[model samples]
Target: MCGIIGIVSHSAVNQELYDGLTVLQHRGQDAAGIVTSDGRHLCLRRKNGLVKEAFRTSSHMRKLKGKMGIGHVRYPTAGSSSQAEAQPFYVNSPYGISLAHNGNLTNSSSLQRELFEQDRRQINTESDSEVLLNIFAQELHHQNSYRVTPDDIFKAVAGVHKRCKGAYAVVAMITRDGIVGFRDPHGIRPLIYGARKTEGGIDYMLASESTSLVTQGYEVVRDIMPGEAIYITHDGEVHTKQCAENPTYNTCLFEYVYFARPDSVIDNVFVHKARMRMGHKLAEKVQNEWKDHDIDVVIPIPDTSRTSALEMAMTLGVSYREGFIKNRYIGRTFIMPGQKQRKKSVRQKLNPIDLEFKGKNVMLVDDSIVRGTTSKEIVQMVRDSGAKKVYFASASPPVRYPNIYGIDMPAANELIAHDRTEGEIAELMGVDRLIYQDLNDLKDSITEGNNELVEFDCSVFNGEYITGENKAYFDELQQKRADSSKKKKNKRAAVDMCNSQ
Candidate 1:
């Protein structure tokens, strides 16, 4: 997953874009980029690092000029971690468009071949965002209009919805025209637009989360609907159109379990509130199953799971304590590409508080267990800290299938809970008991917040791909992940040898 933001303001938006990206830094840590349009001239700056690292100096910010711009923080779910794949990808054709995109396209391989053979466009990197940019540019070119209007832009977006087969939330700047924002038909990813009234005129901003807009004093208008496209002219005029054939509002459930910030709202449901409901629902299961449970204290894994853990403690009538002190400097272990990197980072990322675990029947709560590397390690850490009994609870159900849209866990075997029963998983993790939230209860948790949300992209738990199940695609994805893992291992060995010399 990635974070994308775009702005059309009465003044220069370089600093605003930078600050917005900083707020969204949790969405991605690998790379960051920003592109600003000064009339017809586009100024670009992108690098393989966090937003603060990428735009470090005054000169970097000063170089970016314009009233409209787009920014991106990338976590590579589709491509390698090379600087060449860093985004805010630009194409000169179709009136000079610079685009930033979140979410992954499942049909990108076929689209890449189509672009080269049929569309006569060249793809520079392994990134699907580049292919998407070219597709949008090509579609706009088909419009054949010297003066592009909102209708032409909406038509181009419709062409994109017809061709692309996976999730995408895009924000593009068309040189002198304005900023455009659109969501995929399924709404598998989040995209919200808001407005801020300025002294000069009304300014508009679009981003992957509402936090990016609200933090900047922008009043959230609403989430850009499934299969909808919104165009904000350079003069602050707004126009929108439904671009997809038959759109459904199936937002990704993983966003509520993890990823999204607690303060953000998506599809009219508050994220933190949903997570609290998850804790309450999971608490019901615990109360029914383990009536005489001796959970001494409920301790959260830290950061993302804190809200749920606290609620779970309150519901279960157990004392809540902060057991893990997280190192804020460490990158998220879940998003790290390699298993070795993730394993190594867990210790550096979190340290167990001896007092919380010592001689107590400790119950640890985490958002969800994917690979189980971190969970197993944290369990061992709790044991090492003298815990008498260690129990674990997952706020969401087991991840049994691959998340093809945009998450990193592509191989089923990599998921500890994929083919294992609850008892088997508990044994493997060395926990005394393990409780996982039921899928139906998890759905109710979110639905309680917003009744309108009828479905979600819970493909990771149910193996039900909303786009359609393709065994060939799964096979290819597994092979790609295996190959990438080998390459990373070899590269690490080479680096270690060089350092020793």
Candidate 2:
């Protein structure tokens, strides 16, 4: 998944966009980009790397002078890790639009062909996001309006909703008109817009998470509804419209389980509260199944799992301890593009504390076990830390399928739980016992707080594509990932040989 932000303020928003990207940096680590529009000109700066590294120099900051802007932090799920694929992709013909997108489009291959042949547009990168931007641009071009209005923008978004069949939450800026934001019909990705009162008028911001707006002192108006489009004019006027035919609320379940910050609220559900509920639900399962278990201390796997682990420990009546110390310098291993990178970073990401594990039965809690690489490493670390016995608990259910809606686990074989039984996975990870949260319980945890959210995009757990059955898409995705993996391996071998010489 990626993080996207848009702002229409009274003053230059380059600094605020940069600051906002840093806050949402956890969502993506591979690349960061920002585009600002001063009504007359659009200044853009984007590169492969973290937000700070991309915009480190004052010169880079100085060039981005505008009252309205859009920013993106991206980790590739659709494209290769190259500077050419960096976001805020621009198309000059369609009113000079620059767009940033979160989530993946399943119908991108067909759309790519359609764009090149039918729509007469060229796609420069493998990124589906660029395809999405072009689709929007083409739709806008179809509007044929010299002066694009909010209604025209909404119509363009409706066309986008009709053709694009997957998950997408977009923020696009028209050079002189306005900044536009829209979500896919199923609302599989998060998007929220808020405003703050200022002397010049109301300054508005649209972002992937509420934390970005709240942290910047903007009062949350509400989440942009499923299939809704919001337009904030350069002069600070706001307009919104429902752009989909039959929109459904199917926010990605993984966001609540792992991606989102605890402080943020999406679809009226507090992330921290939902995670606490996940802990309580998992605790109930543990109590019923393993009443005689010897889980002396509950230790979280650092960061995201801490909230759930704390609540689980209290419910299980076990001592809660910080068994692992995390190095703040490392990015999230799960979001790392390659298996080698993820494997190498796991140990660097966290170090086991001998005092917490020494002579104790330690129960380790993690958000979820995806590839099992990190889980295996952490279990080994705990063993090396003198633990008597090691038990593992996942706050979420097993990820048995690929997440086509923007998570990087596209191949079934890459998922530890895809074809393996819980017992088998437990043995493979070297854990004495493994307890996974049930799918029903996971749904309950998020919906308990907000009954309005009845549906979720849990494709990773159930293999149920929300848009429709995309067997062909899945087949193509698997093949692409396999080819990419092979290419990376061969490239690494060539690099090793060169270094030896």
Candidate 3:
């Protein structure tokens, strides 16, 4: 849900970090930050905006001049949008440490309560990053060490990992040595490392996505293994340690379906290839089910679904057309502020090209339909552009369940396809026919020879939650939601009674 990067080079690494963050800007647009270690001190700057808007002037980049640094672009998961919630969160005590993190921690509420009860440490922000920083600080204080070696760092992180549950990919900067990166045991999120070939020597770079590294002239080494930690010293010495003994690889499937850029790769699997496979599988299903009908053209919704559309076009033996032109200036419609704004934004976000759709029986390819709002708008747009008939093809199965893992999907009742049949959904969207990728088909697409290219966390699709070592935390979350709903109902009743009086 966020992007993180770190760099260690013989020369100043400000520019490299800046460019890497730019490549990762798509992962998050809410906030951007960077912390550079100048050996003597860590220069930090963070704000709520895009990378270009946040770091507008040369003076902003010049302030962070150091051989090693860490950067983050944040998408708010738990906390309210504010300057304090923005990351590269620093703790001054025990050797001035700054940390940036991606992914959500399910046990954070429990851990926060425990930390507050044990030690009178007031957490300033609601973000789990601050909780993580405080936990590391507490461990350092408990060990009572000043040297803060790599071993000490690993032990501190392991202690926090034992207490914490859920996903996290972290990058931290220390005053003395340099940058360190770590991924959660389940590997629900992604983190990769790259090395730039410099004139003097090699520079190490760590990022949430590989495209960032490629943009900054660094060749990707590999994805940082799940439950693994790597520390890149100021002198370019890379030290690694494993935090979790037997790690489960539960890479998020939504990343391939929607979140990640097509150019990025995760867990040794190319994102674009995975999407293409999904499209091909969908095409096969459609051919099997609706053999009588003819699909004249396969038209992509633009941007994210283009790769899948191309594969669908080839599979169906239909010509592929760029039917929709996306407005490059607007933010993503899904992440817009409100439903009203998102509905209005969708019109501005995409426009159907009349030449491509006129008199054509178009099959519109898209990744997924969450609430079906955007799909309905797009279907109407295509029909208005003179398409004879519109057939909608979703590359992924219907999202009938809620995504508790950081994706901002609404509750099950709010999902359009959750209760409605495919025929009903097709009528609601005003499409001639609608086809969704089957769940089994999606699973089959990613299967290789005795090995899956990526292990998927499809809890949202199947309603089968994979309980990790931290099963108790899942129970706690369910209970908490129940209590919150009860409390809201009670408050509403009280307010109504008072008004009646």
Q: How do the predictions measure up, each by TM-score? A: 0.97, 0.96, 0.90
Kindly indicate the candidate among 1 and 2 with the higher TM-score: 1
Which one is best on TM-score?
Answer: 1
Q: lDDT per residue, candidate 2, 1-501, as tens digits?
A: 999999999999999999999999999998899999888998999987799999999999999988999999997874676677789999998789999999999899899999999999999888899999999999999999999998889999999999999889999999998899999999999999999998888899999999999989899999999999999999888899999999999999999999999999988899999999999888999999998988999999989999999999999999999988889999777556567887789988888889999999999999999889899999999999999999999999999998888888758887889889999999999999999999999999999999998989988888888888557877888876663664684465456446644
Query: Candidate 1 at 7: error in angstroms?
Result: 0.2
lDDT of 3 by residue, 71-171 (tens): 99987643455666778999887788888888877767878887799965678776778888788777766767767778877887777668767778889
Write model 1 residue lDDT over 1-501, tens digit each, in one string. Answer: 999999999999999999999999988898899999888789999987899999999999999999899999998774677677789999888799999999888889999999999989999887889999999999999999998899999999999999998889999999989999999999999999999998998999999999999999999999999999999999999999999999998899999999999999988889999999999887889999889999999999988899999999999999999998889999877666677887789999989989889999998999999889899999999999999999999999998887888877758888899889999999999999999999999999889988999999999999998998588888877876663664674465456446644
Q: Residue 166: error of model 1 in Å?
A: 0.9
Model 2, runs deviating above 4 Å: 337-340, 483-501
TM-score between candidate 3 and the true structure: 0.90
- The lDDT of model 3 is 0.80
Question: What local lDDT score does residue 274 receive in model 1, on the 0 to 100 scale?
Answer: 94
Displacement of the residue 98 alpha carbon in candidate 3, Å:
1.1
In angstroms, how far off is 81's CA in candidate 2?
A: 0.7
